[model samples]
Target chain A: MSTILLIEQILNGLQFGVMLFLMAAGLTLIFGVMGLINLAHGSLYMIGAFAAAAVAGWSGNFLLALIASLIAAAIFGVIVEMTVIRRLYKRDHLDQVLATFALILIFSEATRWTFGSFPLFLDIPAVLKGTVILPGGIEYSLYRLTIILIGLAVALGLYLLISKTRVGMRIRAGENDREMIGALGVDISVLYTMVFALGAALAGLSGALVGAIQSVEVGMGEPVLILAFVVIVIGGIGSIRGALAGAILVGLTDTLGRTLLPVLFSSFMDGSAATTVGSALASMLIYILMAGVLIFKPTGLFGSA
Target chain B: MISKNAKRTVKALGAATALALSLGQVAVADGHAGKLKVGMLTTLTGGGAGLGVDIRDGFLLAIEQSGNAGIEVVVEDDQRKPDIAVQVADKMIQSEKVDILTGIVFSNLALAVAPSATAQGKFYISPNAGPAQLAGRGCHENYFNVAWQNDGPHEAAGATANKMGIKKAFIWAPNYPAGQDALTGFKRTFEGEVAQEVFTKLGQTDYAAEIAQMRASDADGIFFFAPGGMGISFLKQYADSGVDLPLVGPAFSFDQTILPAVGAAAEGVLNTAQWAPDLDNDASRAFVESFKEAYGRIPSIYAQQGFDTGLLIASAATKADVKDADAFRAALREADFTSTRGDFKFGNNQHPIQDFWVRKVIQLDDGTFINTAVEVALEDRQDVYATECALDW
Candidate 1:
């Protein structure tokens, strides 16, 4: 492969990595602060997509749909937290996993019941529907570039909120010691609810933003959920910074490996053989990356070790 | 002693009267003495729900049109799991005592339940998933496919491609059995070099790298076999990437199930299928109009197959007096029905030997787009690998 093609593949990887970060950041935050394994995180992603589609359909305004997704996802998170999630705080991880898994079933069926089985299409907002010329003579999708920008903004905003705000302080405190914060009369339950909602809203936003380029449908959250889990595991169980690093690492490896491996193999192998071997190896690249991390860093590069 | 005997007689009469009334009510509810039990196994509530919902509705419409006569259809969700398929099939066989077991979308699920139905000697009417094994040597007397084999439609695509004089083609499909079948069928007719063959994960959302590879190869055409949501995702991405190659696929990817998701992106895409909304026949026209009027949506090939399976069951029941499993199996072998696809009959292997059509997507006058301009019976399509099938046919 030429230098230009290699560079282009790297950019593709970066874009994919950024998308994963948007999904992983929310997942890690929820797990880190709440100490709950929320399997319905992907469901919230579906909710965002649905909310955006419905609003965009009604108002014919893309911006309004985007805002509606965030608000709707957060509202949904609060309601779920209040009714079902609140009862499971002291339960074991097994119970948490079961309950959240049940939530996935409920959410997926309800979404299907409401939306029917057909996938809803989200139009890329008209202004951002074209391509952009990049450095190294690469022509990237403007919509994809927009996703990277939005993801960066959200990452920065999340970092500041956790480090700067009073709620952030309470969250940090809750993360370190839940009982101590509750004993101090800080309304620990309410703080937990807020943290869960915030995490959900981030997940929702990610869903809405990505839904434009992809599809909004029942079970849309699942593939992303698995990827996000991989991200958090590699990033550390409860670390946002680790999520970012891990997600990007995953995205780049996945995209670049898929594009480059075949071409690289072709130099030594016949065309068809190279392609079969390359695609097979590419699919396994992420797991290999995960394994390498586990062996070397165990807790992830940015995670506490 | 005589007065006590009179009281006992009166109580017995009253109890008898109550039992008669309840039995009368149940008989009226059933509408007949010989209530035909039809078991419908479909994915009622999951990712595959959309197509399943359509199939379920079509089957119901067929029942409703038949005046809800002769058949008592019991619908259950398989949840797209093979274990669930076996459990549901067992429940239908042993508990529900269904005279006929029908309806499935995936081939794996069909494979799971097909043997059990045959072993029990019940007529197994397949609405979908015509795996090649059953078409050839694995075929059973009790197993009857209302739908064509998975390879049938792709065989039509291959014939069409051959006729169109397409030289080089690239194949991209999900890394699954169905995908392999599609590629194998397509290559059977099209005697050309495969520019590229890429196997993607099932339900893969991102197609950027794959699309990039296709663009680089600069193939004349690409054939894909992704069904349901994956088709929508791929088509949308393909549209965005601005790849100028002609795209073709089987009905599952481009039919009514995915048209809404692909929307404008679906225009000009070609597909090979057995059933389309615009088939030029009175039976097909009536079925399509009624289906659209009832469901407020177009009927997919899955739905058509589902409806046909129900009708086939009804026909077989009337012929065999459904109470007799052996007779029903014999009737299924005869396989006479006025399917939405016009005249239909089963091959010796018990799979539908039917016509396949090449279709193109275009906008309708109602401002909605559908598959219009259907080319009929392209090359008298049948599974190319049927020779491998050791079916008793």
Candidate 2:
């Protein structure tokens, strides 16, 4: 209705898109290099949330919790990669899916066993608890603004790590020709482990950051996992840039659609009818966007053909 | 064999009547020879397990408090599926021969099992999942609910919201029967403009988009009807969205099961329900304390309802003079028990005619969250279809 409200909605969409990007980056990387459809990726996200909650509870500090969550998730990822994931790497996609599905059960049950089926609370630090006034007289949560900034930083950092580093070179090589990379005596097994750990760490970081805004619980990683899958599929599988682009795209579409669709519908219909139609359409907006993108550019906006 | 069966039935009925009068903890156990077979079905492993576990914990604690009776509760995981619940119900009835069927966390499961219990002539006292359809047109004689009907609490919230002069409100719920019942129940009481009536995905985690939409809407309050993990996730996101709108919901959102998960985000949220841990009564206090002592957590409404289910069935068995399912069903319809919800009696529809209270989450002296401090008592809360419930008696 108002310019200010529209601007606020757009900002909200951008923040949501960035959060999706954080989740999509790791999943795309794992899928690109490992050629394994890891269904248990959400479990790693849960691991990060639990780790953050535990560390934050212990130290009474948020920064320590964030660092600890990433490290803890990375360690757990490497351990899982070595033990269960490695066994399925050479196996078929069906086997990998089943194995990872089992991991989800194991992870969820284990977390429930430890946490006793209660959700843990992660607080936003006092510094980021208030609202900030934005341009156009719009108000926004400081914590969400921080997420957008942190998400951008993560994107930049990931870009540098993948494009500039020696490990990045090997990862790119591995993605192109895994057999040749292993044949060149680069300890491909260790490389795979590290890559998995890196993805896990990123997922963990996202979980920790997002946990402050959502309830940290046993299966919290799952919905995010689905969104990340959409992101990668939209951006182009195994493409970081594609993931980033696609995540933002999906996020903005989802947020904006939900906010504006009802208003759009209300123009012709009554309020109640508009709301019912609007909300239903809003829920389907992202998948519709994905379908449209697929129709035109099948590999995704940034995915390699 | 007919004479012997008749005598056993008379004896069970006599015990049930005496037990209600006697106020004995272990009221009726003579009917089930030695092995007290109890089948407990709840959502145990998946998303809805949060509520299921609470119900399970309550049932187990009641058994423990009753000195871990001669009864063996064979727990089955329903996973919140109606079809799975039916299978579990069949197994409990046919194979396990569970003298009592209790502990259902969702209404769909309750509906599936309630009809079957009536057909099979077993006493099915539901701890939770008071479905609307059953409370009205399809009301069963054998099926009894320890919990209030699904509409009861939400109706209280809606009434309270209207009284507070909250003119413009937003209603959000999952797309299901219970969700429909919740919003409908709320709208029945709250005569206000509903800015948006949205149905979210069943297991939706992110509320950013919805929250943003609400921010732009003209609504003064947001009413939500998400339970278990869904409630926890939605509440946390709603809090973080920086909308200063007052939040109100049913007791399901801020119960002992989900309070810990949402933590401080749940603080100051108002809810309407039949049971709170801090209800001003000796029975409620004792139940809460004993439950906490056993489970290392506060007892939720789920637990209270589950415990009530056990008590209801046992009391029924004592009254009916028969340990068999038919006698117990008859006795349960009599509905003679003083429950944790305080002086609740069964209506003709076999649903609870109980008081719904407005409850708020306040920090206890131990720095833990609780739905304490009852504000108002909405008595005899029933469904919109209560008029449709036709009973002979």
For all predicted structures, in order, the TM-scores are 0.89, 0.89
Residue B202 accuracy (lDDT) in model 1: 63
Report the number of backbone clashes for model 1. Answer: 6
Candidate 1's docking class is: incorrect
The regions of model 2 sitting more than 4 angstroms off are: A264-274, B1-36, B66-70, B81-101, B108-124, B321-326
Model 1 reaches an interface RMSD of: 20.9
Assess each model's interface with DockQ, reporting 2 decimals per model.
Answer: 0.17, 0.21
Candidate 1 clashing pairs? B136-B389, B136-B390, B136-B391, B137-B389, B137-B390, B137-B391
Q: What is the lDDT of residue A299 in candidate 1?
A: 61
Best by DockQ: 2
Candidate 2: tens digits of C-alpha lDDT, residues A115-147: 767778788888888688886667788888999
